[model samples]
Target chain A: MADGLDIDHIARLARLRLTPEERALYEGQLTQVLGHFRQLAEADLSKTSAPFRITVSDVSLRQDIPGETLGSEAVLRNAPASRDGQISVPRVVDDEA
Target chain B: MSESLHTLSATELSRRLATGSVTSRALVESLLARAKTHTVLGAFNSLDADDVLRQADAADRRRAEGKSLGPLDGIPVGIKDNIAVREQPLTCSSKMLAGFISPYDSTVAEKLKAAGAILYGRLNMDEFAMGSSTETSATGPARNPWDKDRTPGGSSGGSAASVASGLVPLALGSDTGGSIRQPASHCGLVGLKPTYGMVSRYGLVAFASSLDQIGPFARNVDDCELLFQALAAPDARDMTCFTAAERKPVHLPQNRKPRLGVPRALLEGVDAGVRAAFDAALEFYRAAGCELIDVALPTAGLAVPTYYVVATAEASSNLGRYDGVRYGHRAQGALNPVDMMERSRSEGFGAEVKRRILLGTFVLSAGYADAYYGKALLARTRIRDEYLKALQQVDALVTPTVPSTAFRLGEKAADPLKMYLEDLFTIPANLAGLPALSFPVGMANNLPVGIHLVGAPQAESVLFALARQFEGSHALANRIAP
Candidate 1:
């Protein structure tokens, strides 16, 4: 079991930008947390199979018919930036130079 | 007369409403006044008195027309902020969604409206329902009404405190791992986390999808069950919710005394006061003709560790949608989209949320998945099997809801692992997808002690029956925090 975590790498992967202070704080705390979680390695699961999802028997599925949904105006009401009834975001690609 | 209306049980309130002894408007006004008086308890994140009174007046009109909706008509109920209610700010007590208002009502909210229940306050919770105490909330920690210095065990601390303090007769809370029950235990109330698929989760902001179940907090089991019946209907919007046909098969046998299971090994390190109360509770059950059987749950110790892995993993995925564009807070001065997303998340989420996201990302990362996440999943299966096996030998398993009563605020705040251990007994039920209920048995150290009961899958009726039997004999059933 790894005793320490790469907080910077993990934060990057999680899409969170941590300050040096947060990184230091989380590095210590998460290491201790993972140290406790590492006990899972001691569990004897020789006979058990890890299913990705827990089976819930008799779950009823609705028909494939399209139904009412929130209108664009209502949906975009909470958006940080919007234009012409659409959520506006930072540019994803650079313009061709 | 209005002052005491907040203290009456939902059943009693319903009778008063039926007989015109009290108007829905009167009850809402009473609760609003009480909630304002106890603002120090920090039970509410948002309470729109005008809207609530309007809803109440509508219910009163319906009653006046002799068109009452049912037992819940004209009754006020607090809602945990995570569950969406149309036009209400659903913050989840976090800065991430600070000003966001829900455009649509969650299934639970819709059901409460359909039942003619007046949706009251936006109850506070741990940010994203992440912590055992409400300390993680961006607004502030909700103080236990029992003792303001202490926590009212959480993620649903506000829900428990609101009801326990008589600000509201009923509140809805979601439990991923003991959120509702632990708070209920600390505040001396009845809380239930129904079978995993029993309640629809259409609009409950997901914490951990598999383990998350919305339940009720009330002063007694009857009130809890009444609210549960209102919210437990299956919804096609939530595919994991079980159909009515699927839920019909499990019924508690009325002819025989329930055989209560005691996991002696798991009870080893509990506090002496809590142990004494639990022992007394067991004796009461035994004297009441319940067959007490010593059952083993050997794999239960790993439940906490297993839960962190699974819950964090799920939370990390579910919370990814708050990317600063569609909804929630967005940070300024970012050169690119990726930078903006990262900066927004860093500025938006609280410390505990960031920690979990990092831990989840780490465990699910390449090379580490097999060692941590994969192993935890295997352990989860073992834990589930152990619970199922134990249930086969007993009608229900009984344990202390928490190791001890509510702790002083900031006692476990600095220690994350210590806080996680608060859910030790409660996590197994969530992991196994079984129904569990927590009800106050007695007091320890001038604080309430709760006893927990775990039942078989889809056997909420069995758990409720057992809780009612105990509550009928226990004096602490209708207690309100001073």
Candidate 2:
């Protein structure tokens, strides 16, 4: 069960900045939700394997030939900020570094 | 004639279109008018009357040239906002994608257009398909047509509500857990969640990749099958989709009474109305010669917990791409990229979506990964195996679609745990990647009660046949919202 502090860490990892109210609310809710999730421990999974993978027998792959693709103009249409037919974002790296 | 056109099933409408009794344009216009009057249902997020009429005119022209596509040709179908229809809004009913227009058609949308169906409306949904009730949508909750004050079950609530209220005869919905089936039950429509990978997920906003499946909601099993048939095909775009040779034939065979397995334990806590309706359906199947056997799913109790862990883990990873960068909503001011992402998501996402992302991030976190996410994967394997084993003994497993009828808006909104439990009966099918169908069995207190059927992978035909047979005999068939 995640506490208020734990939720802060989780929110950071998820790239979400939660309001104090949301943090308090989610803390209580997630704790209770996790308590419900504890029932999963009761399952007898000794014979089972972890990291379940769906194995489709026949996965047909298309040829390596390039096909028609969305133009940069169309692709950038939905971007909130764009410049020169490309999506623009706040600089990630420290320019001085 | 136009007044009643909105109520006709796609099958009946197709027959009428074949004989030139109706033009697609006229039928679309009639439905559009009905949709405007019934806007109180909150079923659609965005609809363009002119665009819908244009497609309808194209279908009409095709018929005039004797180049009709098929039964789906000329049918108006509502699309869940999560599924991309090129040049149309694909918001997923979240503020994150408020003005985001899809640059490409999803495989389902492509197929629908190729089949000559007029794609209409961006149906509302739980924000990012996170909630069990449509109340979480940014567009506001989609109210149940049966009871205006009540919610249509979600995250495909709008899909169910639209079809139920006769805004459109057919609609598309994505099921991750019970999103499609639960709403279909609440709205008294037939919804199917096909075996995972049976329908291509390309262009579908990914919630939980392994669990998510795009399926159809229709007035009847036949119409549901018609839409499913149109959508189910090999797509190179989604590698998980069945290959051309791997795709199983969907034809319902001759009338063969199926051996149905009932997990009596799972039905214990269901509402009395739902239990009674389920038992009555079972009794009808038995009297009609179906062999009903008692089945045990010991791990079934673990489905809800296991689903939350697994679905959230995948969702957290899948949603990482929405980091205020290329597309979707971007925050106004931020000193850095990371700050921008955090602020944008925090501002754009609703409470439910934020909660899920937090839960998912926690489960997949370093120290907790083994305890929650890893444990869930093992439990999921067991649950899947249990379902597969049960299906070996019986052609299908029958249960109630949801524990109860359409819940009033905000009834379970404050309690996340209670809302998650709504998918208890339907989650096993998704975990096991099996085809499942939900069809209205009866009504209780003026709300619809639906029965659920889970079949083996690629066993959609069996589910359809059984559901169609029951729907044919039931008086509740073809019922519409008052």
Candidate 3:
């Protein structure tokens, strides 16, 4: 009772890798959950809220003036893997590079 | 002291403070003591006994100086842990942010503080406000104070339970789908989910940002209105806050006219006992000269599907910021950065949360976005139009809030389908972004049942006026169970 999407696809979408047993278990659970959503399909969904985004202003330029510097160590402390006082880790897809 | 403390409604407490029969300090002391006694209910997240006492002392000082702040001055209110209160660890009952302290207060929290209302502690809720039962909480499911074995309905479960058990007079809760009304119906209290943007979302921890709305919980309808007036405003911080909605004045209606819409389609799934109680309430309203007519909202049937798709999609994106990078619990010994993101997220979020995120990611993926998210948006439009059409016919729609009253805690938790069906009656209001109130009509099987009274957006004054008149005519919902 699986859809076109299998366990591996579902896990990949979630950024999770699962064991064989877990894959089997989750596949069944996913099917059941989808079945439950059918009841919602019965609803008449006509009123949609506007797209949700953080209410922040968009001006990328920073003022080129003497501004108070933030403690670099405090900022880097939250980074998972920083090296030489800079954030360092996996390289995202950089087609040009 | 414990029994008396648990029963003081916001209205009664306000009256006592005004008459000098009691000071705010005494009321806060009794509340603080009773909260400790009812710890088994899982009604609170983080509370500083000292801080609450200090706030109460200030309220008394203000009263003595003849500086009454507002109608809710000196009355206590609990912050749903999801709503930020600076200096408190605003854990939304999740391991993700176990000890993360909010740097600033939410607009609602700021409003309550400014109004001279007593700051009660944070109450428990569903993790990310995703589940129908608060059982998904990392802290544990909030207990029904009436029957400890049963769950107090969720997301706002603790807020509802705390008031029902007399631990507090009123508390704040956020409803996306049935988060507020479901729990209120389950626990037999007054819960209101104002129209979208009715209350500001400035500092409420994001959970389906588009659908998430902060609302109030109380023992009666008037108390709910009192908390609503205090918390709602056109905050400059929240862009969604309405500029037109007013903090409804305490309106003692000079006119006897009130109209209620009774939608039979919505009432089809209501339990026999609940329907019996609801029917009795309608008769009472009719006898009192309030108009009750059957109205139609054909598209309301699709609300749950639309809500799940829209809410989950927003939740997946909103929660993406938590990558063990900034706030919340992080993996102690990750071999690499990618490993930390995976382990920290998997360990921090609950099963239900992870499940929703996975579903959301799939729906928003390259191939399925148009079918899932796009179609859900269309359905939402239909639901909104149906509500607008029906509102032209009557003032408000009346129905049973849930299929039945509060059931045993684990009875539906194990079956996800059973749990979601509990929201069937309450999701439409959220989908349409309309104001809906759940008031304790009477009781069924000794458990309280709530009748949903829905109104057009910014039409709270109409709702409040009708509720007061309904209270004046009905059985008084006089049973005080603790």
Candidate 4:
């Protein structure tokens, strides 16, 4: 579990904006939290099986259907800042560009 | 003396409305008056006085037309902060969606409104329903009305406290793990968490989708039963919602002595007072005709872990929707999209939620999914199966809702592990995705102790009837917290 955690990289990915002081503080907090998951990680889960025996629900998902249109303009109406028929967000990555 | 005008239960209030003892507008005025005067209960996060009064007036108008006879007619019920009520902020007690007003009514809110219930206000809760205690509520910790120093239990703390403190007769609460039940226990109210898909989750701000179920909190057993009946019908909006045909109306067994399962193995680590209170409840049931069956659920111990892995994984994915755009709170003015997602989520989420999202993201990452999330799902199956297998031999299983009564606010706040362990008794119910109800059976150290009654899938009617019998007994009725 400790090996699974790479705090520096994970924090960077989350873009936590952790200050040097905050990072130091979070390192300790994150370690204790991850430690619990580690204990669960060690438990032998092979012998156990979840019970599917009791639940009963009437709801079921419908098969996918196409052709639903976003009524009129609301879809593009409230974009933070939009161009002609498009939501113009800042370039986040190469994909956006 | 007649009970205080503000302290009447939902059932009593409805009866009053039926007989024209109180008009809907008058009742709404009283409820608003009470809620405004006693704001320390921290029951509500946002309220629309105009909308609530308008609805009340409408119900009154309908009543004048010989309509509006629904069970909840004009009964003020508070919605949890996480739920969407059109035009009100759906903060989930987080800074992230600080002023995000909902565009539509959540199914539960819609259903409650259809039944003529007055919208009292929105209640406070943990940020995104992430943590157990209400302290994680970004707005502020919801103070226990019993004693403001202690928490009312959360993330449904506000709903429970609002009902418990005589402000509202009934309210809606969403339970994931022990969100509804734990707080209900601590606050001495009746809390219900129906089968996983019992109530539609359409408007519920997702916490852990697999574990979350919205139910009711009320003063008495019948109030809870009525509220459940009103809200339990399936909606086409939530695909996961259970259908009515599959849900049998829960009924009391006739001429039958109740057979209850007591899982002593699971009860081993319970605190002395809670254990004692549970024992007394068992004895009370025995004296009244319940035959106790000592049972064991082997995989019950792993429930908490499985819940964490699965629930957090789901929460991380669910909360990913809060990207600071298209919704509320867009980091004032971000430099870029990447900065927006990062800074907004970072500043928006509280400590407990961030920890879960981080843990969830880690588990779902390609490297660890098979190890953590996969294994947790398997463990969940076993835990659910073992309970189902055990329930086959008995009508329902009983246990202490929480390991102990409400501790000082910060008792477990510093230690995350201690806080997680607080769900030891209640987490199994969520893992099994079973229907459970927590009711105050007895008191401890002058605080309350709730006894949990777990039933077979869709067996809430059974839970209610048995609970009704318990509440009706004079001895238990008088067994209040000293």
Candidate 5:
């Protein structure tokens, strides 16, 4: 089985902040799930290839053309906070880290 | 006719509308009343009787003017909360999108509306379509109509429940790793997961994009087919949707009995009751002149693990957009943009959703990508090739959709691994991009047991044909919930 996942690093990479209880709960649960994935490593699939990469034509790519787009009002309607017709976000790049 | 309008199929409803035996308004009001009365089932996330009536009125006016929108005109259909329907709240049964109104309708919603189907309430689902049972919904669990104590298999729980309980004759659901079929199995209804890209996914909320396909749930195969016909079309909006000419099914010879493949390995550990029902279904199929062939899928055992790796990897990428700037729940009192995003996601998502996102991030992370994600993609190829090889000998594969009937609410929630195992039987089709349908075959302990027919890529019609045959011969087809 794979070693225990770094729960703290994973949460940070995922941009999630977990409580102490949650961290304990997830660390155990994730280990169990990853152990299941360990079974896949046992398979002898050295000759196998993904269907998408093998058959590249399966994906239907649309032609590049200008089409109708949602108006700015409709786009901004669900924003949590808006200022001057733009979505508002927390200030970044503070003087000190 | 109006008394039982809630129970009528979309086809029958359309006929009645054409004959003027029932008005769309009356049917909508009747279904709305039924929905309100059955709120104990937790089947609906958001509903507005006034809005439904208005849409129904428009349908009635269109019929009065003799310009009906084909057969689905005025049919009341439930939208699983994850699919966008314009002004409706696309909640996906999570707090993150609690009040987020969709700016545009999903491709399915748009197609259904153009066909004159009334886009009704937003049905409840597993948060972000991550769980097999709807218990993961932050909104609350959708109860099985068969027994309120048990869960309606999810994440299309509400879609299946609303149809099973006669609240709506039809509903649209997105299936990623058996989300649509398992619930249909548990609820004793018809759920179809179209071949990947057969139906557009433009406005449907992304769970696992490559595996997810929008499909339908109904009481019978015909309604399922009609809903699928209306929803399946080439959409310039969704690059993945195939053109009609590109998806033609391979034809079988005339006057030949169709061969059905039975994957013996996957059936080994099913529940006793489910096994018994499956055996009976096989007997029924044999008696009906189908040639049952034993097929081998050696890598079928790897489906669950491979699904988690691939699905989570895609989910982590898709869900990255919910960083609190554009829409959805935002956190308060944060020092920086990064801190705000962290808290907003942590607080907005449910535990199951967070678990998946974390797992997904881990697999895609630099050090682990080759070990987990890359290996999973290779395993997926092996399974898909195995299935393709097996399908060459048979028209389709038949297996139990879920190992058992609906388990009690919270039965498998505690063990995330146990819950992940629930998708073992259904995930292979998703990995391979094939069409599969689940329909009731029998009842065990008063709960419905479902059997699925998996067909070749873009072979939805073949699956539907086999389902229609089984549905016709069985007593479970039109059985109503108590």
Candidate 6:
């Protein structure tokens, strides 16, 4: 599994860009961690198909009235880049490249 | 610094405030001075003395007007950085949110404010609440007040340290896999991780949503209970919070001897010093008229691996919101939006945070989901079922909070797996979503040893009853950190 695992692909899927050093380090570390997880494979699943428990029932619901919410200025307080009461980011659509 | 006031519990301080013996501004100032003197402990990340002073004055004015909010009115309390406070930088001791100021207060903060407690400062924690020791903190680790050479167990190390050091009588901490209990144990303080959904999680920076529960750290059980009552209320903002009707009070039988379950197998590998401390605690329980019942958690060995799988999967998803676009730190000069996000996160998060994110992503990856994530969920159920079955005949389960006392700084820093194992005893309570409390029982090797008490669902009151009784009878009662 370690030889076949694509560390780069996993990092890309997770939207993280790891330095080569980080990639190598995490590759080894994750392998060891996942190896520890192999113990769960020894569990007998004859009785338990999937363990699901619903702690919250469907009965409780809050009223649908509009209430106090963060103002646009307040929401933009932590934005690294903002303009015109909105968070500005890198271009979403790209030119044909 | 008003040493006498610093030694008082929140409940005792509250009475003083009620009778006008001491002013809020004086209390806040004294505590702030205490914090400044002990800055070497690295317990707090950010403290605006001016803002804290202003809040204290406001609290004092309300008291002067005969309009005290509640039991916590005019009390000064520090908060763990992961839980939000309006206008404070919610760094969670990570570089990712270093400059990020919270636009709103978390439910716990809101409750504390409503009770008129001064939201004193932002306490240090494990980076993103990921590590057992605060060593992962981008700001630096919080040192144990008892002995500076050792660590105050974390990720709520700062919360526990602040209270134990007399910097504050109370502080709020979030426990996702024993962040609160372990630290409280190491620092010789009282910490509670109330039943899941007992407290609202609206404004907390999520590490593992389902497993995270906000609770309190205090010098005594009474103060812990007061803070718990303040924070444990339903909020529409958090759908998972327990409603008034859904939460039922658990009663301990008055006439019969309370039964305490001890998992003998689980206690096998504990350190000699910790084992001795546990035996002394058992003797106390036996003398106090509590029956000791031997119980077994057959699946307990799988808790660490199972926790990592489930916690990381949720952490990976919950932390996806920290991309460069919305808020928090963003990197410069990215060619495209995708590049911007990747670069930002790579630069923003710490090494420990990235490792967990990577593992989370790996486990949840398409083909591996069933083999890893699915199996983990089932194992979690088994652990929970084991606890529930054991709890039927016993009122609560007892174990050492950690296998040993606080270790020297950097002892387990190099090995991620070793650091993860620190949560061995505390993780099962989280997996089962049961309320657990950690309080100082005795000293081992000159360091405080904390015993963990796990109660059934909504059995917080019963746990407190047992803890209060133990605190009163034990020789370590009111043992303060030096």
In terms of TM-score, which candidate is strongest? 1
Ranking by lDDT: 1, 2, 5, 6, 4, 3
Task: Please give each candidate's TM-score.
Answer: 0.98, 0.98, 0.89, 0.92, 0.97, 0.97
Sorted into a CAPRI-style docking class, model 5 comes out as: medium
The residue ranges of model 4 lying beyond 4 angstroms of the native Cα positions read A13-15, A48-59, A63-88, A92-97, B1-3, B249-252, B474-482
Quote fnat for model 1: 0.84
Model 1 TM-score relative to the real fold: 0.98
Q: Summarize candidate 3's per-residue lDDT along B311-336 as a digit string, tens digits.
A: 78888888888787655767777666
lDDT tens digits, residues B94-155, model 4? 88777666767889888888888887788988888877778898888887776778888887
Q: Each model's DockQ?
A: 0.76, 0.74, 0.23, 0.39, 0.68, 0.66
Model 6's lDDT to the true fold? Answer: 0.89
Q: What is the interface RMSD of candidate 4, in Å?
A: 3.7
- Which RMSD values do the candidates have, in order? 1.2, 1.5, 4.6, 3.0, 1.6, 1.5
**Cα lDDT listed for each candidate:** 0.91, 0.91, 0.77, 0.79, 0.89, 0.89
Model 1 residue B188 lDDT score: 94
Each model's iRMS: 1.5, 1.6, 5.8, 3.7, 2.1, 1.5
Give lDDT for model 3. Answer: 0.77
lDDT of 5 by residue, B388-407 (tens): 89888898999999998899
Kindly report which residue stretches of model 3 are placed more than 4 angstroms away from their true locations once superposed. Answer: A16-25, A38-97, B1-3, B244-257, B475-479
Which rank order by DockQ, best down to worst?
Answer: 1, 2, 5, 6, 4, 3
Model 6, C-alpha of B249: deviation from truth (Å): 1.6
lDDT of 1 by residue, B19-123 (tens): 999999999988888887999999999999999999999999999999999999998899999999999999988889999999999999999999999998899
Model 5 error, position B259 (Å): 0.3
Q: Which 10 consecutive positions of candidate 3 chain B have the poorest summed lDDT?
A: B244-253
Query: Cα deviation in Å at residue B218, candidate 4?
Result: 0.3
Candidate 6 lDDT over residue span B351-423, tens digit each: 9999999889988998888877888888888899899999999999999999989999999987888889899
10 residues in a row with least lDDT, candidate 1 chain B: B244-253
Clashing pairs in 2: none
